[model samples]
Target: MVWTVMPDFEGYDEACSQFIWDLPASYNPAVDFLRKHENSDRVALEQAYPDGRREQYTFRELDELSDRLAVGLADLGVEAGDRVAVVVPQKPQNPITHLANWKLGAVSVPLTVLFGTDALRYRLDDAGVAVAVIDPTVRDDIDAVRDDCPALEHVIEIETNAPAGDVHAFEDVLTAPEHTDIEPYESTPDTDTAILYTSGSTGPPKGVRHSHALWLGRAAAAYNFFDQGLGPEATVWTPADWAWGAALGGTLFATWHHGGTIVGYPASGFEADEAFDLLAEFDVTRSFMPATALRLLMEVEDPTAAYDLAIETFAVGGESLTPEIVDWIAETFDSVTINEFYGQTELNLVVANNSNWFDTRPGSMGKPLPGYDLAILDPDAADRGVAERLPTGELGEIALRPHDRSVFFDEYWHMPEKTAAKEVEGWFVTGDLARQDDDGYVWFKSRKDDVIITSGYRVGPMEVESAILEHPDVVQAGVIGVPDDTRGEIIKAYVEAAEDAPAHETLREAIQSVVREHLAEYEYPREIEFADALPQTTSGKIRRKALQEWDAQGSVDEESP
Candidate 1:
């Protein structure tokens, strides 16, 4: 399954420019890939792990499974446009159920495993989900709230253990024979594909709506630019879930559309060595992960030399990547090739620094992707018109207007007020704050909502944590604004030390010194605490709100956040 560098259609600049240019009318992403392998025996899915266990589904096998599942759903009166809430961990069952729903033209509402009962209930109710596909761990929670969810009529369990009496098992559909007379449902490009829930730190998570057209448009753009150019066939490995825009928009959708095989670990979650082993074994051509995971891989020292393969691109997103991490990947993997992209749940990748052609500037998230009109606007200044783009070097809210492109979200599901708040005229305001440099590359700082203001100085917690992470002693860290008597807010950091380091005052002072030297005086952490681990979502980003709440509740409600 390994692939080496072959005939490339476009160079770096051309591929980067064309990926943006060819986005408007590309095919629908969901069905395109499935269609390509309908009549073939190509390994459509290689869902495997390093521990000598796996599930391999050929293209035809996958298509048939989707068909039978669609029939099973139809037999239960599941109709097109019905919202099916899926609350499952990272497993193969997730994708199988998702594609089945897609085949039936059903709208999927994917909830993260980290969600508590309240969060899950809100999403289920908000999206008017009638049926749920759940893992065993959360079956009791759904049973607890089933009465309140009037729209929710069925609970299909995808569990290793037996569930409560009224619930049906997910295996029943697969084990049963397909309905031969079932008519194939035609899904158009504009069909409502999914409603992915956003993980909002402050308020209720908004469900971002996307159509088949928008989904396919992103895949087409990737194929025409970096993908097809790299190789006609590519093997992609990513831990990206269907819920995240980057995973749904970038990896799985794009890979499938290009007839590429997905070589993922067989286990529920990712391990550092298993990932490397999979790449080496499959000759994985393209891979994607966050900078956090990349940092872990960098610790291996000579990772590429150890597991050699032709990795055409290393795509990263979810947070701002550090210069050291990018440098290590280039030296270990390839130079001028770490493609860092910028995006949120609300929008797909509006900007990207592609590995094909453009020169990467370490920490900078490259210029706006073609077709997206990116602007940095000062959210603090109300009088300033929407057209007023902030001067280069000044921090502002990152806004995007898709020009000559049909590749953006339809709207936030049932949350019109929140949707209006994020959009200005025609542009979508990515809650993230960033600044454009003189060279036109954008530099990410912090979330617009997560900004900390102390006295008169505005401080970004990312600046503090980014510097704190540099100290060899720290394993994980989260920086948040804590209310103070003197300053309105002061920087307080909760750090998880390396496995061997102890949580002591001396270590805290040393951590503070690291931040003070690397960042501005105001951006340094004034208070620090050493903990076993910092709170993180299923996606692994440090959850600052959880930390802020811990600081508010006297740190005793350590579990509250």
Candidate 2:
């Protein structure tokens, strides 16, 4: 599919020069995705499962399905402003649940299928979910915590065999009368649409609430980062879970807002060969991938050599992209450059390396997207109630002005104190460290908790990890600071060697030598440990916290003398 009206941008300067921040008083994402493409029978979602089953749905079909589900849910006593938890795998039903909730002016709380019983119970109880739409596969997990969730009243099962006692079958819900006379709820821009929980790396996952306007605000991202205009014919895909904001907001909502198609596939785990196959099979035009997934994909022998890929734009996030991975992609794919974006579940897509607007910088996180005011402020200023912007090239905490209501989140659900702690004066502290160059490009450093201070020098693990990745034998790398009596904190590198590489003293010296050449001698790792695998989060981020704990427990092998 080709766009009816192509996107126009002179360059990065012109694209960021102006933006439209006005949102309609009353807006619904479901209405926008369907009404804009109502006249055309374009495919909205195409699902491919590992079991060799494929499903395709048009915009009209999804509209009807969500409409029926909304009416059916309303029949089950769900009302406006109520909390409804949606836990499903990557399928058409996932987005359907979101649209259904929006249609009723109800809040949709997305939960990843990876969550265990305890994690599920915490979020369900915290959000006070009134009704839950869950995939049948995890029914038992929910059932284990059902008695604990006092606010949970009903359970609706989707993609399952039959309805058990008290469990409402999704098939039955969809069987609602075709012409059920249920009027769509009229929700203002301020009406709540979703409560997305963070990955809970530091502590318990916080429920980040977003209004309908916040969902609609992603349009600027669709334009600047995606290089898409109205009625774009782009087919978007991402390996990230639908529950995460990157997939929900970045891929699904962004693509639909531009009237583009979304491609989805079911895989037990990520396989580079299968991913390449899906790209070629569906002829995906645009895609988003986490850096971890990209690293794994690059490990495959000649990833792009075998497939006839139609992907034109590839955007990566969730972690930093090293120069090694960027160069690998450049050499493998024809006319394809890696576009990196920076955002969190709380704030969708704030900063990006937009290839359409500017050249793709390997390590730079790019400038802020239109409609956002971003800066590097002194971290100590958080207690003073006024953010002090650091000079160019000075590393500091990244902060955003909270006045951008169209793009910023409303609050953390049921946690007023925590929400209040996130703001200082009028700035919302992102808690991530970064520095901006004079050219207006922002370079991501590390999370505030992940930054290391050793021997009177500050170091971001990303730079060290990037340097280590340049070695031929390294498949993946994780860097952390260990307790040191002399240096306060010393750099320790955990290297995951390639399948054929051996763990030896000579290899460790070679890895350290690369860092010494690329960075200062103080930044190089003093100790290197070859490991079979590194700890990672379900969302594909390296779990530095876990690595830190392992170091505390002395789980890492001692460095060779």
Candidate 3:
């Protein structure tokens, strides 16, 4: 698929001459996009499974299936604002359920398979989910707690042969009704569309409710700014789960909203070679993956040998992109851009590397995306994290004044107190610290809570992590601060060494030496611990909170942090 790259933000409409944004009053992203390109030659999805089973669908067919699924759901008593919980891997059925919920004006809450019974039950009860679509493999845990979930009325198993008690086969629902009798419900765009939950370090996960306007508005801005190169004919791959804000808002919704195609490689397993082969076979134009997968790909002496598909935009998030990974992509695939953006589940891409801007700044999460107002506030100021807003070329906590509140995450679902805690007046405190250069580019410093304060000096973990990654023996690293009597908190390093390197005290000292030489003495890690592998969430991010907990519990007894 050929792409017409926009020369500037002003030329976005010209590059995609047929670009149109006409959202209904109750603008569900699925229904809105399906209505526009129901008859167009737009490919809605292309799935290639591990066993070689492949399937493709046009926009019109996807719309029809969603309609049928909606009719079936309505028959099951799902009403407007009702919650439909889906726990499935990356499959076409996932998208089907998403649109089906939108068609009925209900909320589609996608739960990742990584969560166990406890997490699942919390979400099921918290969101007041009535209908649940669980994959047969992971449905056992859900069934165990099904009795306790009072709001849960129906449990539909995806591909299970055994039909236990109240559980119904997923295929039965799809085939029950081809009826187009389902009427479109009138929904206010500002009403709650989804309830996304996010996990915390201390307690259970918190649900974040997002409205239809927030979903579409974030999609529109991201569609216009970050992905100007994608055409309506392009196919994109996002390794992230749809549960993630970046994937759901940035890739999934934005792609369909802009009338583009979404391609999938729904492999439940992680195989670097097989993943590379699939990339080559599909000729995927745009793909979003985490840095760890990209790092593994770079380990291949010549990445082009396994997969030589034309990658337009190689984007990554959920973790900071190291200089080595960024430099490798630029040196190997010069045409493909390796860009990083800053955001959380609460908001979409508030800052990103614009497509037309060829300038790539390693360690920097680019400037604010177009149509966003950002300010870096001093930490000592009265705003708790953001003291006073800093001017251009200053360092402070990165805060944003969203142009439209409706386009942001509605609020922490049922956690009004926590939502009120995050919102300082009107500006959303991102909990991140950054410094802007003279060119208006924002450089990530650290998370406000994650920052280490020693001897009244502030230290950013990313800078130290990047420095440690440069060491020849180190493969991955997660840095944090532990209670220190001398200093307020001392920097500690958790290192994942190269496969051949010995996990010994000597290596720990050597790692410390490297950090000390590369960065400031205070910035160097005072304590170091080696690990076989770092604990990460399903999204491939090192869970620093879990590591910190392990330190407190003394469970990781191998070495001291």
Best by lDDT: 2
TM-score of 3: 0.91
Off by over 4 Å in 2: 1-7, 38-40, 163-165, 229-231, 301-305, 556-561
- lDDT for model 2, please: 0.80
lDDT of 2 at 194: 86
Q: Which candidate is the best by TM-score?
A: 2
- Model 3: per-residue Cα lDDT over 1-561, one tens digit each: 111122334542243343333444545566666667544556778887888888888878777778888888888999998999988877777878888888788998878877778878888998999999887777789888888889999998876666788887877777444466566666667766788877453246788887777566556545543456555766677777776777777777677776677876666766667767767777777777777778777767676765677677777777777788877887878577776766777776677665455466777787766445777777666255333777877767777766657666878887787787566656777778888988777888887778889888889887888888877678789888899988989998888888777656878888888888888889998888777777766556667887797779866644422
Better-scoring candidate (lDDT), 1 or 2: 2
lDDT of each: 0.70, 0.80, 0.74
TM-score of each: 0.89, 0.94, 0.91
- Candidate 3 weakest ten by summed lDDT: 1-10
Tell how far residue 401 is off in model 2, in angstroms.
2.7
Model 1: per-residue lDDT, tens digit, 1-561?
111222244564454455433332333333555655444577767776445777777666766676677778777778889998778755566666677787777888877666678877888888999889887878778887887788998889885455658888887755466363344457655578788777766566778887775555556445433435322367877765555666656776577766777765534555677667777777777777777777777667677678877677678877767777776775776542567777666677667776555667766778876556788887764223364578889998888887643457778887787766767766677767888988788888888788899987888777778888888778778889888889999989898887766557778888888888888888888888767667776556788878877777666244443
**Model 3 steric clash total:** 2
